[model samples]
Target: MLSFTRGSFSDRLFFHHHSHLRALLQYRSTQRSLSVVGLLPLSIVMSGTRSINDMLMQAARSKKGAVAAGRPPASHIAVEKGKTEKKKEQKVSAPHEKMKESGERESGRKDKSPSTLEKSAVAKINEPCEKDNGTAVQNGIEAPMEIDSTREDKENGTIEEQKDSDMGLEEAKLPDSPDIPKISEKISLPPVGVSEVPSITECVSNLTKRQLEFDPKAAAFWKKGEHVPFAFLAHAFDMISCESGRIAMTDILTNVFRTIIFTTPEDLLPTVYLTANKVAPPHHGVELGIGDATIIKTIGETFGKSDAQVKSQLKALGDLGLVAKACRVNQRLMRKPLALTCAKVLKTFKEIAKETGKNSQENRRNKIKSLLVAAMDCEPLFIVRLAQGNLRIGLAEQTVLVALAHAAVLTEKPPVAAAQLPGRLEQAAQIIKQVYSNLPDFDQIVPALLRVGIQDLSEVCHFTPGVPVGPMLAKATKSISDILDKFQDIEFTCEYKYDGERAQVHYMDNGSVEIYSRNAECTTGKFPDVAGAMTRYKKDDVKSFVLDCEIVAYDREADHILPFQILSTRARKGVTLSSIKVQVCVFAFDLLYLNGKELLQEPLRVRREYLYQSFVEVPKEFSFAKAITSTDLEEIQAFLQDAVNHSCEGLIIKTLDKEATYEPAKRSNNWLKLKKDYMDSVGDSFDLVPIGAFHGRGKRTGVYGAFLLACYDEDTEEYQSICKIGTGFSEAVLEERSASLRANVIPTPKVQGRKCCGCFVSFLFL
Candidate 1:
């Protein structure tokens, strides 16, 4: 049988000693006010009464010394083995039921005339009077209604529903307090304060009222302690059925946090809706706010600890974790900075039932011993989490946001929607927070977040597909130096290039998949891991997701990717999982089409921001390709060397500027690459871009090795080869070159025939 119990250490202790009268007697309040004491159950008093009742009934049925009684004592029913009521003891105890409800005892506090001896003398008169029987029956059902719920009442939720108007109170599921010993020592508990009910009602009533008095411009409802800063967020696209986007809800809009700032609640529906579709990738890592680092440092200083110590403390609260060391190398998982989590604030007097112990395991069986509610959301994925980066199927921050929105259970969607909702983020969030607090199920959250705003709740499909993602690279590279040198001033960045195949991974609405290589070839079978990763990480019922990544080969450990040749291992049919271990590393460079929103025209900076913001971190085996400043030949060289050292051939540098479009099948200059082997050896730089090729001859007959190479004749409208160099050759290269020639082969391909590529076309000494 499954058992559900929860509570904190203090709560458990309280539950264990709940029934002790001696403990209650230590509290003057319970002793002075019987009315209050009677409301709560005291098992000991009742247990004594049951025993007395049984003995009394047995004695009444006994005949006092008839003929049979004289024959033997065997028929005499003794209450105990060697005990009996004393013949001289005529005193009876006061009926506990009457003593419990009679508030006349409180009258003594008002008028203290009776002495202790008088009270003792009067105690006998109050004992078992014939009138006690009538009062006992009436008080048994009415006065002792202190216990919250009967077993049956709790099971059907009749008591909960009736108590709070079906507000989900039954879900609390707290454990039962244990029986207390009558003679145990007292325990002290912190004072409990009653919330100001009227004030709470006031805040809840005027929640959505526009033009609130405090500060119309500032979105806050000046509450005690601190003001809540709220912003309303909305979603921005349509999606397909298989995707997280709720196509029907794409149009939904909401302002969640706006109201929450001024003491208003969040607008959970729209935010949840926007998140459902993954408008952004699902990473939760974020750049620290201005001065936040200093603040952390200051706090650490005040605590007389190093930044690391402060950070560790924060991690204990689930606020911080390790980070990556460098872009080129494997992630270092450092904890340089600290942040916070929802669990941090909730540590105050709040704990789950599963966290406590005290009650017997058997007694605690399936007892919904205790429950606590809190609003929680995921942070963006950092470089530390290898797989859950901006790649094939890792979750990003936006996914978490969506999940949170859905958790709120507002009008089916998060506050974010297709329509802009920057003005409403704060308010939308509060509402969602309430929803999340009440119900924390993933299914509930996903559907709500995916629901397109302003849609008929009856719509079968919520998410849409074909959302274009990426135009997000920078422009204006006067020199590689311009990118490398000026990045910091504008917070710009550059990334490394990979020599593997680039894939435009499409997640179809029908739950199908298609992976298109840069050359527009369908290479889906060549990389099954890509599809499998997506299927697993993506939320259930998500129909589609289109991603951009580099597919490279791998050894047994998926951490390192092999060269292009290794990709051949998976190029053929009937490749068993173990037979061919050259797995592929789909290096996710960016997020293109997530859910239904298209980010095509957005700048590279914007795209990267979205990518980083959306994804939640997962560990290595998959990851986002690291990036840096585009220029600084020195840095680029270092990066290129790093890439090469890691078995990569080159580095592709991307500008953070967003003017460039990611033209699939088109090699635009915006994304230029520098290979480790491309440096000039003797003199002049080669102008070959692998333009066209010719049929092979001689030893290269079956293969296309001695094929024509091209140099750009800028003056002409065509490309002509200055050389046809073919020196670096291997059997495998010969075969691959032969196969690749069919597409690039030109009918009238021409070559200089005299000298080959990389050879000095000596204009110097000629």
Candidate 2:
């Protein structure tokens, strides 16, 4: 009798079926052969059967014990391990499995199918491991089996979806393991078929094509005291340029500012100036001094292109920044360059500005090339535009101030609540705007804001005696009647609107004087004679003061003021008191600061009194503006006539008391100018020709918005730029003019005697 104790069904079946054959062969063979063949088969079967039976019995006992204890048997554990291995394998191959399957199908292998074993394996792989409990015997151990439906799905080529699902599950569980590195931190591996590493240029091109995404966790990744990469600002500029709405631009800038504030507080000042397209405060007279020629040449040398090629690209693209970006995509650097930082760019700009004297152009080119070589993605675009001193993005100065204010408030310690943030931002923005108007210097305001907070920013950054303040502006009225109507029942004063450069004269207690233009540029070097004359005319008691005056070209012997065109002829730099050819008179109007005290908050009447008491006037050299305090329409008209006869533009009417505080950088209703051009009659007309046209924006799109007019100088046989005319044109007229000038537009301004206007008037007609 054969005892089938402790054997799996398959093992017992194999032994029983072969037992019959072994017995027959043993009976048919001779005694010797029977002993060798029949005994060999019998012995082998018995021995294997004995060992498998023992192992099966042991496994059966364990399964019984585990069932009683609510635990899986050993085979179920193996199945779990197999599933895990399969999942990992699937992850490694999931990216290419579909391609392999499709390739196999295309090669006339549609009839090919997976073996039964492979189908079973795939079925086991698809089953959910967490719900697996049923066990079936395999060899001698009990293993879990999968449903038939999964096997059928695999046969139908639906296993790709299962592979994807498994991969997603693995990724989901990754965060639970702290030792596992993140996907981004993992080293990138080459694709399956790729044999060679990508070139640097190819890598950069791929990176450039990828859209830039702003990461909210940027601040967390940056180490403390690390200089902010210039790429951050460049990215912000790219976003700002694409957005036409003010609010959207402000949001982008605010995020950038907030990041800079959190990561590198010291870089905030330079970053702000760069965003404003300035290298330093206007009073410092620091400029990039980089011209288009230098930029074109630098790009050519750096990228192995000719100047003509660069210019052709520039003309086609209409932006040198874009041209640089296009050229940079194909250029390869000798070695990996160090990443550019905000502070580094600003310092390089100052260095470029200092590149003067012999071989200065070459030095500037070298410095610019270093930056371009290090630039990646949109960096070259912004760097070129920065060197050009015009970002061309529609970012306004006030928008920058708003962004800065919001950033400071948001990044303040003991962070603000979400509900109160908008209100706080608005309040802080107003405070910043107020303080900046009083002192329009980021060098002073940004540091103060960061140190003392926006609450005390005004106290820390008030109007200093030496620092230039943005001059107050006036709104133009159509006629004297309009000015009288606006200032009805309000005491007002009329002063001659002198046709000269608006100069802010500052006299320091150290016996040194400085002159600044209305835009806050230091003109001390350009008007040394005016600086000397301020000392000669100041009162003995006045030690330091900031006087808002106009510097007009004057004829001292004839005691007459010359036209403003004559004033513009003087040398702009490297001027000495003795080298002055065009003499100018300082017509002081409003006193802004006196002896270290700010007079901006005082009424115009009080400021005028201070002005008159603080300075002594000399004829044709230094004097107060010709003024008359009156509201009579006839008297104002007569005064206007007198101003016109004196070569003044018109009359400026200012309020005496109510709402008359000096509002810096504002075209306020408190002051109005009655210009001769605003009158009904054509007071003056120029016989000039249009040399070039500027591209329009906003509603003036697709047409020339303005024309550069030049007057012929008979003595020099040259075309002198007189003015830019953008007004008094209807849509029909603009389109007509644009059509007429389109044919005459030349690739370059090749006229021999044309003066450079330093503007974006590229479509030259002459």
Candidate 3:
């Protein structure tokens, strides 16, 4: 098993930005297109700057190419006019007159005139400067041994003997500032051809070997080790947007898992939770409590849309997330959005869940709006969906587990093949599913799996005292014969199924007790007596264990169990011993966990043996259910009859096969329920007042035969009309009652208010 610390990967990747880029490149090359990766650069700021530099370098290359291809040199061209141009021109031309005269004298020839073309060319070459304090010019070929003082030279210093110099060469270097290359041209990317693309597996392998992180500005891009842009999940959503089949979803989810496994495995848990549209497991009790009204208000407030506008969109689109998406798309005033990450999304959800006090709704609304503000385009659509818990991608927890299992298998030393992947995946998924059934929290499961592996994770999966495990359920059967046929050649046990609330009672080593209902909701206070009764039986073998039983209302004086109605009178919470009215008994039928070890895999026979030996039984207070094991149909029928006679609902037939084990969140055939509802019984009656009559069809078409009835509520001081009395009355009874009801039928305007206020019809027979 591999042992590791949290944030180790993040620390390694965060500080080294280049390795992050290398990972990103490998990821893009191997899995998605570069265009998809374009928006999510490893370093957003640096990528932008690199693009600008590339453009500038390309322009410099083009300019150098133009020069080598015989284009005019930039520096030698005519210069643009500047602030000092006139003064510079006057200073330069002053030296030309002397140089021309000196050239004529030196050549020993009278220079009567120069060609117009030659003069203009000379003027252009000598336009900017004269060397050595204006002693040189464009026209001068050479000069030696001169002593003179021009207006400009005299102001500077005394004239002395000077040497000949080239004026045209000096003019070439006169321009003080260099010209910049034009950057107006467009740049294009190379085309992606078929030969350039890589396989998904290859891409995954390459990504696994590299590290990745986002730019600093994208620091908001990660939350608790999860990266941003949200595009990764969005892309996966796009792939399965229209897919419906389980196989197709599994394929898509498997790929998504592969993507996360290779790129950002830290996000796996949050992504799974989000995909499941849950903040945490049911047992963990984390709830967002965000409602439609809150989401609507947030959309209107954050996106600048009016309630009417949002309502109109909702009327057209039906989904609030879609409405939010539309509003954001059409918003005139949009804020620059920070990249959204799985971690950030989960963090926001956690904060929203943790908010309490009087202003919690307001605080929650603000947090939700803030998240919406940071979302862009399709991101808002998904963000709203996640907030609303309406991800509705047709993915369930089971499918996600399967996907995670596939990812785990692929991450193995010798990767499982695609053909053999499904079988291995199923095996991995069952282990996770079983563990989750007991632990029931992805927050605990996913991290453990990441640190160790599936095998080690299965070992850690055990029933804890405080945490509730989903109780195993049974399939319903109609008769004793049906139950016998199902377990024909097997040894099965039949126990009375009591008429009471199913509770999972956990006794912790600290001497604390908790009782949870079948739905895994805490009902500890409601069953205070049950907890107190179990404390007496806390032996060495049963100090800390989970017991599955039926908590029934008990009549202490009569020494018998009461109906479910008596138990229903108990308060839900804050049940005080002094205030107790409905005394109850816990009929424990099965033991799942004992002394901190889960016996869920033990056969029913073994579990029952342990359950019987663990604790002392007290009649009608805390005792195991009466059981009789047999294959005889007649004996089972007698036991079923005895259960009904003793006020039990019916019988619970449990399979005693060696392979029979407790499977949570599933209704297996190994356990069967036969309730009294399937048996014959005398019907119960209710106190109902006759209201109006309905004419029967066909046989008594014209006559008012059936009567409408209502039940009286003592507390509300109002009568609630319910059910129609159409079947019980005979012709003789109806005939004797017809006249009395007619005379007593009150007129609509004359009816007076009392216990019953509507128009009344009283039957004399009653």
Top of the candidates by lDDT = 2
- The superposed Cα distance between candidate 2 and the true structure at residue 550, in angstroms, equals 1.2
Clashing pairs in 3: 20-212, 30-203
- Clashes (backbone N, CA, C under 3 Å), per candidate, total 140, 0, 2
* Model 1 lDDT per residue over 83-175, tens place: 111233122244645433332333324344432111111000011112222111121221100112112231322111112111110111112
A best-first ranking of the candidates according to their lDDT comes to 2, 3, 1
Each prediction's TM-score versus the true structure? 0.31, 0.65, 0.62
Candidate 3 weakest lDDT stretch, 10 residues: 1-10
Most accurate candidate by TM-score? 2
Q: How much is the lDDT of residue 116 in candidate 1?
A: 19
Which residue pairs overlap in candidate 2's backbone?
A: none
